[model samples]
Target: MTASTHWLATAAAQSVLERGGNAFDAAVAGGFVLHIVEPHLNGPGGDMVALISPGGVDPSVLMGQGPAPAGASIDHFRAEGLQSVPGAGALAAAVPGAVDAWLMLLEDHGTWELTDVLEYALHYAETGHALGAQAAAVIGTMGQHFSEHWHSSAAQWMPNGQIPHEGDMIKNPPYAEVLRRLIAAGFDGGTRQRRIRLAREEWKSGFVAQSAVAFARTSHRHSSGSDHRGVLDMGDFANFSASYEEPQSINFRGTTIVKAGFWSQGPVLLQALAILDHFDDEHLDPSTAPGAHTILETLKLAMADRDAYYGDSASPRALRQLLEPEYAHGRAAEIEPTASREFRPGRIPGLKPFFPILTADPGESSVLGAGEPTVKISGETRGDTCHIDVVDRHGNMVSATPSGGWLQSSPTIPPLGFALGTRLQMTWLDPDSPSALRPGTRPRTTLSPTLLMKDGFATAALGTPGGDQQDQWQLLYLLRTIVGGYNPQQAIDAPMFHTSALAGSFWPREFHPAGVVMENRVSPDVLADLRDRGHEISIVDGWSLGRLSTVIRDPASGSMGAAANPRGNQGYAGGR
Candidate 1:
């Protein structure tokens, strides 16, 4: 079974499963296909994080997130007369990690050759795939910027001086050639593992690196409304490689919830669960007013800590203290019937938490490139990242979120046919900040994927793609499924809400104290109750909040189930 944000990617993955590939092979194939089908959401130059449980073994995190370049420093950015990392342009580019990471996973766990796995992406990119409405909508929104500033992008996305409409067949020949070259690099009659490694070498040290750096060195318009040359160079690419790490896990209702470590926002869900564990099942239900309030407050608390403490530099001791039962109860004790509007990060005796400057002011909120570029920030949510989940009959399960390098957020490199990701915007210029800009350290990323384990076997894999809201949406699904007894489809279909009360991880960071965006399908009485409690409410359309997808396996029976979000008419799930 397989589920993904785009129907085509889902079909590609399901096809792999039907052809006897495991979950890892299907996920890698689908991930590459997404680079073609969802170019407005993700690309090869972006980053991704996956939680993989191979054949019911313990899950490990595939750390595809790349670090800052050797020249990326707060002092250098300050010297350039910048207050924060620009949300767009090559100045914010990281070492592109998505392609290498996917290839590595395939080499390690997959059964097929690299040529076989890449065929789906090559076909779509070389010929054409019908562009989704959301992708077209985003391109239309960025059309003027592309034409006026990023001319190469305009040539690729809006040729003939017109924006392509929904369902228009789009082809990216340059990217297709890039894929073909990688496969060609591996055709030396070597072992499968050696062949994939050779492809990775070509990517980091050959044409992909040279072409990207050369294109980025030219000045371009940034989200800050200024022109600047990017700081990335070939050395940054040559020095980085994706690797595996132990995933952090916490028990909830007798089941182990697995997520990536402090470097990503995955632990926010675990911390929220710990706090909510103190409450009864009634308080965990998101459909009721009291339950909704409790859930919102709990998320705000967890997110506050995320802003304060989570980063590549975060220590295990601090994480352990944060998840301690007594500490969670103490934090939960702070919740009140009325909403609390303060930026409240808990006190850990020796660690002084970093607090970002906040205001009711919406700073640069209207810039299309400043936040998650796919989201239509004009009060209605459209989209952001891309996600996929797959579970095979052999018990291999995977959940992956691939984001950044969207067309709107950065200029398209002419030769490579994709934009470098602006992930550096997540780093702070403040030296004291936990996620402060530092050469060779990873910027704290919001890309998160989740896995579930029970009785020593992996049971489920699920994830979504809303930057900071990624895990928040997953939290609601877990609560509904684990506590409220809803099936995967029911939990995903339930109305969703997320708080923006804490500092945002994206560029021009802003916070809306006590702010909540929800589907209007949430009871009007409950909405009024939230308002009465001092929560600032912005109600959107009924099915516009979440883009979650999930695939679950009955470990004992080897039976599988899958579901995708109904919102946006894009996500789909399928199986044999």
Candidate 2:
């Protein structure tokens, strides 16, 4: 079974499964297709995180997060007349890691060759695919900036000096050629694994790296309204490679909740679960007012801790202390029956809390132009990311969220046919902060994926794509599924809401104190109650919030189920 944000991508995964490929192969293929078909959301230049569980082995994370360049320091950014990294530009980019990570997973766990997995992506890029409405709309909205400031981006996305209309056949021959070169690099006469290693080396040191370095050295316009050159060079790319690590998980009720490590915002879901563990079954039902309120409050508290302690430098003991049952009960006790109107991070002994100043209201910030899609609906702008999930017959499961380096994020690197990611914007300039900008440190990334296991066997893979909201949406789905007894589809289809009260992980670092953005599908009574409880409420269209998708495998019966979000009218789920 395969579930992804785009039907064509899901079909690509299904085709891979039909060809005897395992979950890893299907996920890689689908991920590449996502880059081609969902260019506005993700690209080859992005970063990704995957939780992969081989049939009998333990689940591990493929950490695709790349670190800042050796020259990207706090003083350097401040010297550039910036209080924070610009939302979009060469300076905002880190070394691209998605391709490397996908190849790494394919080499270690997949059955297909590099060519086999890449063919689907190549076909869509070289021949053409019907342009998605959202993709076209995004390109059109950003057309003026691309045409006037980023010529390479305009040349690639705006054909004949005009934004392509929705459903138009768009082809990217340069990107196809880039993939072809990588495929050729892997042809160095050796075993499959050795060949894959050669490709990784080529990516780090060959023409791709050379082109990226050259592009980074050139000055480019940024969201800060100025031109700045990037500090990244070939050495940064050469020193970077995706790695494998154990996933952190916690048992909630009867099920185990798994997520990526502290480098990501993933653990916030686990932290929220620890707090909610104190609630009764009825209060956990997200379809009702009390349940939704408790969930939102708990999410806010967990997110506060996330901003305070979740980062690469965060200590394991500190994380353990935060997740401790006693600590959770203490934190839960702090949640007033009324909504919180302040940025309150809990205090843990020996751990200094990094309290970032709340700068400006998110609605007024003009520095909000990273990889997030700025779709206008009901006079408000919203953002988007990308996600994919797969489960093969062998019970091997993979969930990956590939995002950033969107076409709208920065100017395209002509030779590479993609742009640098704006993930560096996630880091702060404050040296005292855990997510502060530092040479060789991974930005506190928001790209998170989830895997569920039962009795030491993989049972489900679930995820979504919504910047800081990723874990919050996934948490809601898990609650409805594990606690409320909702099916995968039912969980995904339920009314979604999330608190944006914490400092956003994107550029501008905007925070909405006590803000609660929910779909109108939620009950009017519930919305009113939330408002009365001091939560600042903002209602959007019923389906404007989340794009969650999941695939579940039944170990006892060997049956698999899949579901995708109907919110965007693009996601799909399928199985044989």
Candidate 3:
């Protein structure tokens, strides 16, 4: 029931549920607290994306994706001969939208008042909490990133001038003051404060707002004779009006799905499911040693097709055949027990070998699990990201991935108390590709939030935090539960799969069907069968790929069940 990651985060979610708040409330609360507690993972500076279904209505996705400021580009970086921008500078910044989105949701959909929702977060920020093992672990590893910037983020994190260790009373008195100011005065004096103060001040029209002048006097500190006072103008925040994204629904593999993306991985997930419909899952269990091969082969086939045309819908290509049931059945039909990594289970020639990449050392662990490992960040940066799932009493679901982890490429706006996304970190430095490092292009993200509906009602709202592994985990967990018959926890806890789309490869490709890099513990005989089938197999640890977040609504009891990825020590879900 608590966010083991941090007591403050858990308390905030609990506060929401204790009142009349629903899944979205809990998530928003969690996100706010995440900024205070797991500051490195998420903050107001982050952007948020959520998949939500209220009662009988279809699901709606909310996008809080921040834009790459008025100007910024990989070309600019390359021109400067720099691979990446510093984490806390205008160069590394993205216009933040998570707070705006949360405020919008609170205004439009939430049942609770803004102050009610923020009370717990404000208290936590004001009254510090003891740091948890998880937070301490994240801070310890990310200190080097903190050291990069002499000012901004690098400074705030190392307060007391050093990274605090585990069990320390992590405190941020300045951030606490920021929240207090936000609650009382709002961003732009009494103007932005109207959202919260409107109810009380309706009788007093004589009150001309002077809070703006007050804020001006007390707001941001001038940056060392440097004009980089990154305080967002209240006008800028006031001008933000969330677009009414048309809700779209599609039936994929008999599952009624709804979302808010016309060009995101959400649609691609639908396409992947469509292709899966063509295959057989009747006896696809990994329990039977011999059967694991078919399971691995089937996944590989699905993944191959996923990579080829999973692009912006604007570009039409040959994909219908790939979705054809008979074709997928034929591809699955060709599976042999012993084959090379080249026998692609997909429609096209599978993903080419990763050009011999001098892999960065060996195994690198992320504080909150790794997202998009293969989707590398070439340059420089610092960041924070996290995921949360909530199921309310009415069986509604809210699944979200809110990230500030690293500002897509900007520094810490201290007064902002939020980190921008290093999201630009996702783009290819290449100036020519679709997701090429362009001036304003949003990266082709794999952070997809999904709400899987059955019988015209959302039965599951799920997603994962692994950048590229997101869709992969989302689809895998769904299959493992809906078809594979694993329980919610089992489905999430199960050893996940990921294709190593390496830089380059040849004689023995690593990104093939059945080409699995499994945890060393899976039965050797079972792995041997996968290996015999031409898979380029490697053995990793017990916990691996696709750390997922899921909420399952079982109609049988009208109750809910949930599970977080085992990779991270913290994740909690339950009905309000």
Candidate 4:
């Protein structure tokens, strides 16, 4: 996908595939290089979740999300009353498992050497990659996040320790040095003993393509980009490792299926799907006028289950009923067919009720009038995307996503040029139900790399990184494109919207429409109607105009197609 927040990043990912590396190899290089080239979004310390479709087998998934440090404890926060961890505190950090996860996938599923897999990242770090409009914009706005975290993050990002203007060459030799060392430990073909003859090998056999490298290198020289040298070291590389596991899958109505592997939110998809499957599709056609009503019904049910009952296995919630079809059927029956229900508290059979009165207020007040609604440009969102989907000449398909290490609490130990992700932000310290922060537990995450199966075979591989928004985006696109008969481009290009019980709620799910911004593209009357209903609302430019990068491959053509939402600077869709 070219419109990737960083085209240079996409160019690098594509280069990996062209060099004969598979999607796994390409995704690894892309994540690394993006960290070097687009530090504002994400870096090495970030986590990743992948959904891959191996030949005849169901799609297997991977979770490299880091866990709380062995010593992190709830008692600590309770005594301190720390509701939220700061961006730089040790308490906010986790044992980064992203790198180890990548290595594990490679060792288990990748056929190429580590050197071949991470070639693009190696080059971009040793040299430098260029910046783009989208990448620049996201950093410009979030500069405060960097300043609050590490000096390395700021010194390299801030111009003379200040924010750089657009087009500035944000360089970081210190960060670059980190990438150089990593390459030296692996990439450079500085073999001590080379025979007079080069081994006769095609790119498919695992050779870094000269053409791809030069293309990416040339792209780096002319553009404006960041200098985030990765933080891996010789010792870290030697110590990094991985393993394999069977994946989990669940079938949904109308050719829908969701899969996850050991230690991920994948299983949640199955639970939600089973829950939705309980609904009668006869009245919920999404493309029709009734779709909106159905969507709200399904999302509310899914989110409620997600909020109160969902948690890491280490917690004390009973999920057996959540995944049971009978429970879903009973829950769906609770919805009043004629009217949208107000946000309220509900119990799962025997569970206690939680009345989450809607409680959020207006956000980002730089306003408009009854006549002229001023729209604020969406700054580059942090560590969002860069994914690759491949169905090899062998018909084995793979889909992988690499994320930016979050800035809030991600710390970089200078010499490594990389940062540790403060993934704790994904979890709530004071969760009223389950999925709350606990000692050594992974949070309920948004990165669910998915492989959609239809007609008993893989039809598409898709996923994105937009926190909780990731689910609605992926779900809507898949439902529209694959199920509703829309093409990939049309599916993503179509207007979109999400019902956030949190952002709009008075406190968290305060049913205030003013705090909830929908796109102006919607029918104005529909907007007015929702506002009249006490569903707080505001209007954002693209709340429903399109989607992030989502790629689909039709086995019939042996070709891949991608559609990127143009609202954001770097959304792209293309194939080799």
Name the top TM-score candidate: 1
Per-candidate count of clashing residue pairs (backbone under 3 Å): 0, 0, 39, 40
Residue 503 shift from truth in candidate 1, angstroms: 0.3
- Per-residue alpha-carbon lDDT of model 4 for 421-457, expressed as tens digits? 5555445556463445665566555556677776656
Query: Per-residue CA lDDT of candidate 1, range 355-458, in tens?
Result: 98886665663346555753332236646899999999899999999988888778898888899998999999998889899999999999999999999899
Query: What order do you get sorting by lDDT, best first?
Result: 1, 2, 3, 4
Backbone-clash count (model 4) = 40
For residues 1-576, what per-residue lDDT tens digits would candidate 2 score against the true structure? 999999999999999999899999999999999999999888888899999998924989999989999999999999999988888888988878998999999999988888899999999999999998888887887888887789999999999998999899999898899889888987974898887788888889999899988987898888888889999898999999999998889899878888888878988999999999988987787777788788888988898888888888778666778778898898888877788877778889999988876754544334234535532222154557788999988888999999878998888999888888888988989998898889999998888899988788888998998888888889889998888889999989998888878887877666777788888898888888888888887888888777899999889899989999998689999999
At residue 574, candidate 3 shows an lDDT of 44
lDDT (0 to 1) per candidate: 0.89, 0.86, 0.52, 0.50
Scored by lDDT, model 3 comes in at 0.52
Scored against the true structure, residue 40 in model 4 reaches a CA lDDT of 52
**Against the true structure, what is every candidate's RMSD?**
1.2, 1.6, 7.5, 9.2
- Candidate of highest lDDT: 1
Error of 3 at 119 (Å): 1.6
Model 4: lDDT to the true structure: 0.50
Worst 10 residues of 2 by lDDT: 374-383
Off by over 4 Å in 1: 365-367, 374-379
Quote model 2's TM-score.
0.97
- Per-candidate TM vs. native? 0.98, 0.97, 0.75, 0.77
Alpha-carbon shift of residue 404 in model 2 (angstroms): 1.3
| Candidate structures ordered by TM-score, highest first | 1, 2, 4, 3
Candidate 4: RMSD over Cα atoms? 9.2
